[model samples]
Target: MTAQLANVAAVHADEPSMPGIVPATLARIKVELLGFIRNPQSLVFTVSLPLLLMLIFGSVFSGPVEGTDVDFRQVFISGIIAAGAMSTAFSGLTISVVIEREHGIIRRMASSPMPKSAYFIGKVLMVLITTVLEVALLLLVAVLLFQLDLPATAALWGTFIWVLLLGTAACTMAGFAYCALIPNAKSAAAVTTPPFMILQFISGVFYPFHMLPGWMQTIASVFPLAPMTRGFRHVFLPDTFKAVEAGGVWNLQGIVVTLVAWIILGTFLTAITFKWRGPRVR
Candidate 1:
């Protein structure tokens, strides 16, 4: 992706007087956005799946958390917000790329006269837009049905922003790297769904992290999603809720470190392994 962007930059440098680059980028973005919004499969992944999970979990656990005053509904809402972002940013993006590759859309785009960087930027922007909307929908539902309160302080909102942005970046890069694993678009769902579902269960999205066995918690901690959910909990839940977390404390430092590390690792892996050709062509 960086190489593609560099090629674009070189082209722009050579044609410094070109006045249509901005318009071209915007045109690409508009086209991609329209395609996404019109696709029912995209809507299911980006909108319905997360909202359904949020509704189910929030309704099922409609009480204060055991041994704490914090409401379980609130905890589920916070966790599901993170999970929704993962659904849209990581799983959603990965599967879309796989299908596009299978259908030769990516290959066609590569052969097009459009700037690769513009296409790449347009896709990334679409991911950001969809993920934000997914989170917003979850929050709106939580507020209306469960009466979730908005975070009041600057620090809380600041932490929420950091976690959301960092988590999205980490997950998006990781999704790109994951594309190398899908041998065909047919197997994309088979490969992607199990891991994401398992992560959600073990990483405290479906239950409290501490309830899992110590070894399982340790394993979950190695992944970005677990820390991402924890970060959300820290900002949204009361400080006392940390008592039940894996370390019995809010590990903001660990959250930041793990997410940043994953972002870098994912970027490196993506640059090395991402394939432009689909399985049939390869």
Candidate 2:
């Protein structure tokens, strides 16, 4: 009995204690979030672009978007929300990382004993934090500054939040994908941003999906941001709102499909392409 007990104790001791997922991830995230928050450029992206869009569309285009009867406030707000989430995830981090790689941050980190997973997890956690903050900030401004109304259904807010989280995750994966595939850090801003900005504009972030031209709408509908924004609008907007034209047929389903497909594709690409080190930077 004593020998058996001793063996059991040894085995129990050898076993990993609860895997430490939450605590370790939280600690790593705290560090990353601290760095991210302090970064001037990161703060600007996570806050500025969304604010700019909100002010531009909210103030200038107060009337209906070209393609739909949806009020600019109703249709455009959700898209800006989605855009804010995207800006936080990919724009801030990706460009910064490219500079980091050019500056030898990646090489130095590689030389150290840091785990690649830790770096990834940290960035992911940081993205999550920023996304949440960005959403809150935008919403606060939308409410207090723009006097935007609360959602019609309470459940819609929850759905909106979920879509935002997933959208942010998709963008983070996108950022990782870029870091791995884009050869040099020097050109990171030049190449990655145009597609992202276009994705936002064409995908209905600044306007209603119905406003997009036929080909552009087709492309945007299948992509991530438009679907997310449309879904988000569905949850919050009123039943009387004409923006629900694509509800069962195109709106909600499109959101789910786009998010799932992009998430899978982005994650796969992110995994295969990501690298911590490379040729010496000039």
Candidate 3:
């Protein structure tokens, strides 16, 4: 008994002391951010693509939206902001996580002394930071180059903040849950990109929500991106524009409820489906 106790004590002494959650998460955040910065493709897709789309669409659609006084550019900017957030939170996370899993990084991390909760928290927080930066850059360009108007009231700004936070959280969790669909790193983009691209088109990122076909609008309504786009439009566009949205109203309560529902669903799915090992591993 005494010998066993000494062995256990030695084992515990050899093990690294676990850091507090904050410090551990912060360390993971730093690592993730550095990896993101080093990967030029991530920067281009997550940040540059949205900016390019904004400039092109903003320039091409110069006139006022049909049946409304608001510029089409303004509406497009709002949708694109949501698109940017989705790209960073959803598409980026899915692809990166799949790649890491396939490379055995996730497996190694699982066996390490690091707290899994801290690691995931770091990932989510990193995504939130990147999403915020991407959205801010988009807004800056929208305001400086496209002359997009800022929210006129504090209430509108409040709406923007909550919508941004909730929407991002939903997308991040959804991305984490979606890793189960990807079979390997090779198919990550193939599995993830189609849904993301389709959502952008049908969810009003590339066009006006009210002008989409009835079927498309119905599909978009069920997903998170459409509601996020509508929420953003509420912040930047005139209140009168809400008359043109589905059901002829802004539906602020509905937006919150939809995003919150997605957050819950995504979290549940992630809890059940996420695997530390690669898909093919025994």
In model 1, what is the error at residue 280, expressed in angstroms? Answer: 2.3
Q: Residue 235, candidate 3: how far off, in angstroms?
A: 0.2
Candidates' lDDT values, in order? 0.84, 0.73, 0.91
lDDT of 2 at 77: 80
| TM-score comparison, 2 vs 3, better candidate | 3
Clashes of each: 0, 1, 0
Residue 4, model 1: lDDT of 100
TM-score of each: 0.88, 0.83, 0.95
- Tens digits of per-residue lDDT for model 3, 137-221: 8889998998889999999999999999999999999999999989999999899999999999999888888888999999998
- Report the backbone clash tally of model 2: 1
For 77-124, candidate 2 gives per-residue lDDT tens digits of: 877888888777887778877777777776775565455566678778
| Superposition error at 210 for model 3 (Å) | 0.5
| Runs off by more than 4 Å, candidate 3 | 1-8, 280-282
> Where in model 1 is the C-alpha error above 4 Å?
1-24
Worst 10-residue lDDT window for candidate 2 reads: 242-251
Clashing pairs in 2: 67-211
